[model samples]
Target: MQPCDLTSTGGATIASRFYEPPGRPRAAVVIGGAMGVKQDYYAAFAQWLAAQGYLVASFDYRGMGDSRHGPLRELRADLFDWAADFDTVIAATLLRGGGAPLYLIGHSLGAQLPGLLTHRDRVAGMVSVAAGSGYWRDNAPQLKRMVLYFWHVLVPVATKLFGYFPGRRLRKVGDLPVGVVLQWRKWCLNPRYHVGAEGTPVREKFEGARFPLVALSITDDELMTERGTHVLVDCYANAPRRVERIAPADVHARRIGHFGFFREQFQTSLWQRTVLLLQGFQPSQETAA
Candidate 1:
């Protein structure tokens, strides 16, 4: 792993790391992380992909993790800024790849936001892991009520009390700027998530995505329901998509919850499956353009 910070839109710094393959890479990949999850959280996965003869890149969005500046309250950023940060990483990876094909491996909110990127057309395809719309109404049965409580009570109260969400201290979603917290709260409350909450403009942006996407939904995911996953992926109406729902038993696991897919123990089973998708995946007939 090598440190390689990037200059994002508006000249801000995005903390990043690069993993070089042992031999000449056949392709390159960018591992976009879930919201509030640091780039470091993806270090193992990135290294594993690099070993598969692919250059890999991972980074922290501005105002989170290693990219975070001073106080959280003072950092002003919203979804657009986060999208631009993702674009910065993509632009850099394309340059480093030296004409090799570039693929995206996105987790959770990372998968949801790539449609907002202007450079998205440059991507060959994407593997969306645990991707979903965070609508409280469509959340997993076990998590819906708690999600309602978070939207109705916690988000407003906490963001107001601290001028930002103290998610790191609360051990919830991780520390977030007030703008991101409030904006995400709106999306979670809406039936169609961000597309509905933000309207036509956002919908058009998602429709602009032209590559193929394979969405992997874990049955035991505590935060995402099957309906929610479909709803979120449908936002990218123009992209050829194949949504695959996997059960824990299929992978011989007791539980493969929302975050367990990256635990490294499943490297041989889950991670290897991911590498195959990155290489040989094809869109199913129903979703083919």
Candidate 2:
């Protein structure tokens, strides 16, 4: 594994790691999880991809992990900023001396970012793992949705009224930027703004992209339902797309929620299944081994 720093077009620096096999490269970029989550969570998955002869790149968004923070006075979680950072990373990877066909893998929010890059002509394929198509559908319980709506409205109001969003407790204190938080609140509550490739009307620019796609979802995923996965798969009209639903028994384990699919034990099984799907093989003991 090798480490590198990449700067976005906006000049935000990002810290990243690349894992490569000894032979010819099959390069892939992985994206997923939230800004608050640790990058180490995906280490095992990246290493496994490397072992499969793919050059794997993983990075933390700016204002998270080891990457640079926002200017102290204007700190915030901005999705646009995250998207810019992703674009920069892709540019750096393609520009550097390498010749492998580029593939993209994004989980959750990471999955949507790749779809946003309409000019990604070099991407040979894409994999979206648990990518939400529409936020409104994912946040179930009409009452919870209403509460979130109220929170979005009240939080911004309170932030302006009291100099901080009320009840804005950070999972990692001082790890979040105010701008980012506000942007997220706005994006989360506005259903029209968060349309991923799954449910949205595809733009003309995306019509030309013909790369193969794989959408992976687990039956018991708390964050993304089977309906949401279907919505996502429906959006890619031009590409050869496939969906794989992991059996309940396969994904059942302590603390194995949405993010657990990338951990070690699952890497050998669930993760391998995803790779096999991408490779056009039936995922079973014979093919995976």
Candidate 3:
């Protein structure tokens, strides 16, 4: 993986890595990471994808990882800034691969925000991993138990007190800009997630994107519930979307929680399934582990 710096359309610096195969690449793949996660966290997966003949690009959103330049308290970025960073990586990946068909692999916030992308039509396919609506009402019980406290007290007090969220110190969602935390809180508190919280214009933008998408959801995800996944998928109303719900036992694992899907341990069992899906194959057994 070669380190590179990209400038978002919004002019924020985005730190990234490019993974290229030794031979001609089958396609270009861009990974969009979950909130609070960094680009390096996905290095293993990107390198493996490269070995599979897919030139891959992975990056960190502003205020995270190598992308962060200064104190979080001084950053003025919001979620939309991160979306712009996503588009920058996509454009760079396409240019680097000489306009190869591009596939997107988005995780959590990474998946949920693609509808905001400007070049939605250029995308060949998308793999939504652990993607879901963040409306607190639809959250799983494990996370629901603390939703009230997090939304009502923690977010409000923390952001106001520090000019940013002290999530790293709290061991919560990691440090985030005040603007990002406030806007995200609105979506999670609203029943309609981003669409209802942001209004019709945002929903229309999502509805305009057309692509074949596969959404992977694990039953053991403590944060995203079944209904949460359903709501988020519905945002891409015009896309041909397929939902894949898997239980840990089905994959011969004891626990494949919210983040385990990318672990090297599941490369053969779960990762190859993603390869077939991106190749547009119709699995004979669907999702037989």
Candidate 3 lDDT over residue span 92-156, tens digit each: 98898775678899989989999999978888889989889999989989899999899899999
For model 1, residues 44-161, the per-residue Cα lDDT tens digits are: 8888888888889999999999999899898888878898999999999989888777889999998999989888888888999998999888888888758778888888999989
Residue 178, candidate 3: alpha-carbon lDDT:
92
Model 2, residue 109: displacement in angstroms?
A: 0.5
Worst 10 residues of 2 by lDDT: 280-289
Greater-lDDT candidate between 2 and 3:
3
Residue 4 of model 3, lDDT score:
95
User: Candidate 1 deviates by what RMSD?
Assistant: 3.8
TM-score to native of every candidate shown: 0.95, 0.78, 0.96
The candidate that wins on TM-score is: 3
User: Model 1: how far is 275 from its true place, Å?
Assistant: 1.0
lDDT per residue for candidate 2 within 26-106, as digits (tens), equals 455545444456567688888888788666778888867778464433544466677777777777666541755667777
